[model samples]
Target chain A: MQKRNTEITVGMFVAAGIVAIFVLAMKVSNFTDFTDDAGYEVVAEFGNIGGLKVRSPVTMAGVRVGRVSNISLDGSTYNAKVTLSLYSQFNTLPTDTSASIFTAGLLGEQYIALEAGAEEEFLKNGDVLHLTQPALVLEQVIGQFLFSKAEGE
Target chain B: MIDFIRSLGRWGLDTLQRLGSGHLFLWYMVKGIPEVLLRFSLVIQQLQSVGVRSVMIILVSGLFVGMVLGLQGYNTLVDFGAEESLGVLVSLSLVRELGPVVSALLFAGRAGSALTAEIGLMKSTEQLSGMEMMAVDPIRRIIAPRFVAGIISMPLLAAIFSAVGIFGGFIVGYGLLGVDDGAFWSQMQVKTDWYDDVLNGVIKSIVFGVVVTWIALFEGYDASPTSEGVGRATTRTVVHSAFAILGLDFVLTALMFGEI
Candidate 1:
């Protein structure tokens, strides 16, 4: 009976440990929603992607549809080439869909926001988005405000 | 003055000798691991004593730590008007630093001391010598299973600590405070990377397990066969394990996160 009790308790302990790992992966992290095979990659180029990170979310109309998989400089165009891995369910995005960087809240993370255009074609793998807006730079906004004020004077 | 210098030299020599034997003890423990696996019941018995018994303390402490983090994090973050980030702050700290380090400390206090005392008492009672006289290698028959159980238990305990702590944070943040549930969980999911944070925490706990268990077992095995010696060895095990854990944590954190 003592041996049986030890076996039972040990078994329960191991089970509990596994469940804890499951909770960590599922609820506390983005692992389930961010698997590689569940998404298709598309490239978006911008003049500036200020504060944009690799794993930043790609959302359409405030709903997260994918994530930024890679960010690099486009050598020939000197633009920021960002590879977006959009979820497979959102494959029918218009070929002329516009992607813009938008900050969440007042001082929150930056994410790519997509606005669909009137295009019959759908964006496929290796498709480069042409209609893109760069991240808004706070310094530039302030400088422009000052310049316009001086011009008014 | 001459006697003082002679005693200093004696102390230094003793220290070096113990260090050498500690490494040798580690090697024998490793060499005995196969036998431990072959006679797996020994490991199960140790697992009950070492691992299963430690669960209640790990869970309770984990919850309390998480709750404290939640309350403290919420207070600090509310000042910046960034209370929505309470989840990120709570989860990151718990998973990255607090979970493994604090749980290991607790494990050292609770289980590590017990292990040292038990083994030390066994030595003082000459049970180990009796086994040796019976042609059984005490290192193989006794120590290895306990060592393996400790190694397995530490990571699981840390994981439980982190998980329970997160739940505790949620209780404070959402139930008590009024942080949006969606914001709390979504921000946590967005910020905490599985590979970087959770995996690294696991790695830290595993290393801590190996170090703490080795220290406890070695101190016990090397204890002089007397009551006072057993007591002193038990105390030394806790002190040595704690210092090794903290120092090793710094070195590991530097290696893991220093560059990036």
Candidate 2:
């Protein structure tokens, strides 16, 4: 009976451990989304990507629909070529959809924000987004303001 | 100066000799694995002792650690008006760093010390010598099972610690502080990647488990078969395990996340 009790208690402890790991994966981290790998990749060219990183979320109308899969430089154009992997369910984004970099909160993470266009043709895998706004560089914005003020004087 | 140099040289040589024997001890434990597996009941018994018994400490400490993190994190983040990131702050810190590290430290103090004392006592009592006289390999019959149990239990305990810690953080952040539930959870999910944070934490705990158990078993096995020796071995187990966990954590973190 004592031996049986040990086994029972040990079994419960092991079960609890497994359940805890499951809870962490499901609720705390993005493990479920990891398994949902059905997605289409589209490329966008930006003048500057700023702090945009790989795996940064791509949101349409402030709702995340995709993530930045890759970021590289186009040697010829000197543009930042970013590959966005949109989930299969969000396949209806129009061909003319515009992509822009937006910062979350004050001094927060940067993400790609997509604005849908009124076009009949939908974007497909490997399609390029023509309308892309670069990330807002604070220094450049200040520089432009100073230059404009000097010009006005 | 000559005497100091001679002592330093002796210390270095001693350390080297111990390092060589530790490796051999680990190899013997590995060699005994097949026999240990064949007699799986032994492993289960050790599991009950090491893992099952330690659950209470792991859970309670985990909860308190998490609550403290939530409170401290909220206080700091609130000043910046970023209290909505309480989930991200708590979950990331717990999953990435605190979970495995703190649980490993506690495990060393609790289970690791216990293991050393138990084995050291067995040695001092001449039970191991008796088994050897009966043509039994005590390494196979005794040490391997406990070693294997420690390795298996460490990761599980760490995971439980992290999970419970997250729940405790939620209690403080959402239940008490009224942080928006949706924002808290969504931000955590968005920021905490499974592969990077959770999986890495598990890997860290596994490594810590192996090292802590190895140190405990080695110290116990090498004890001088006296009461005083066993007590010293137990103390060494906790101190050495703590130092090893912290040192290895730094190296592992650099390799896993440094990107350099």
Candidate 3:
């Protein structure tokens, strides 16, 4: 009976371990999505997106409202096109709400930062964001400095 | 002086002989793995003994490690005005390196020593000889099951260590420290990749499991069936497994993520 209890507890231990791993994998790594994930899509274009990836959060005034749903290259315009998924609660972004890619902190992940515009009209699904500021490339900034210094020399 | 030199030479020869014989023992023990499949009870019992019983130590150690990371990472990051990235540092460190390497070290000390001692005790008790007299292969029944169990339990223990460690970090970072709860989790999600970071960690733990268990069983099976021998074997298991875990960790890290 004592051995049986240890076995049961051991079973529970293994089960709990597995459950914890499942939660970490699915929740943090996003291996699965059970939610309806109710949200609408909006698109923005930029000239450069440094280290931006799909599923990058879209934040409005420092609050996460959605995520980057897709990224593509505009062949003709030579621009980067990004699709944003705005959650149903945060669907009130004005048509002119500008999107810009920014780093959250120094040496941190890249995310899309949204700035709400004063327009009374709100953006809808498949609507394109007219104003976008490209991602700031730190390497480009450093390279520019080096070139300028060389010219001065 | 000449007599002492001859004795020293004999001692060196004995050590070499033991090493060669021990290698053979390990080889034969591993070869019994196929036989283990037909005898599931043996493996299950050892898994419970080795993996399940060792959970508390792994968890407590993992929790402390995460708390340390949270506390230390917060202080260092706050200096750079990036305290919110605590989750990133904690999860990445735990998942990538500490989870596998530390847990293996702990497992070596806990389960590895226990395994060596138990097997050594069993040998000294003549139970192995009794089985052999009954025309049963002790290697097939005894060592293989424990070996297989260690291999199975190791990765699970590692995963548990990492997952719980992350929670410990959450407690320290969100509950104690003033980091924003959302930012802590969101930052981790954004930063950590499943394949490159998480899967590689699991792989590392699996590798550690195989190597550590192999050493534990090898030391036990090869130790002379005596009290002093058992004690020595147990010590060797811990020392050998620790060194192997560290050396393997460095090599695995380099192969998985290093520029070279």
Name the top lDDT candidate. Answer: 2
Task: Give the clashing residue pairs of candidate 2, or none.
Answer: none
For each prediction in turn, the share of the native Cα contacts (below 8 Å between chains A and B) that it retains comes to 0.71, 0.86, 0.38
- Sorting all predicted structures by lDDT, with the top scorer first, yields 2, 1, 3
lDDT of 2 by residue, A1-153 (tens): 988988898899889999989999999999988787669999999999999999999999888898999999999999999999999999899999999998986589899999999999999999999999999988889999999999999
* DockQ-based class of model 1: medium
Ranking by DockQ: 2, 1, 3
lDDT of 3 by residue, B1-260 (tens): 99999999999999899879877877887799988988776777787899888899998999999999999999999998988889899999998999999999999999999999998888999898899999999888898899888888888899889998998998999999989989899778767777778889889999999899988988887778999999999999999999999999999999998969
TM-score of each: 0.92, 0.96, 0.74
Q: How well is candidate 1 docked (DockQ)?
A: 0.71
Please give the lDDT score for candidate 2.
Answer: 0.94
lDDT of each: 0.91, 0.94, 0.87
By summed lDDT, the worst window of 10 consecutive residues in model 2 chain B runs over B251-260
lDDT of 1 by residue, B15-125 (tens): 999999999999999999998999889999998988899999999999999999999999999999888788999888988889889999988888888998899999999
**Which candidate model has the greater lDDT, 1 or 2?**
2
Q: Distance from true position, residue B88, model 3, in Å?
A: 0.7
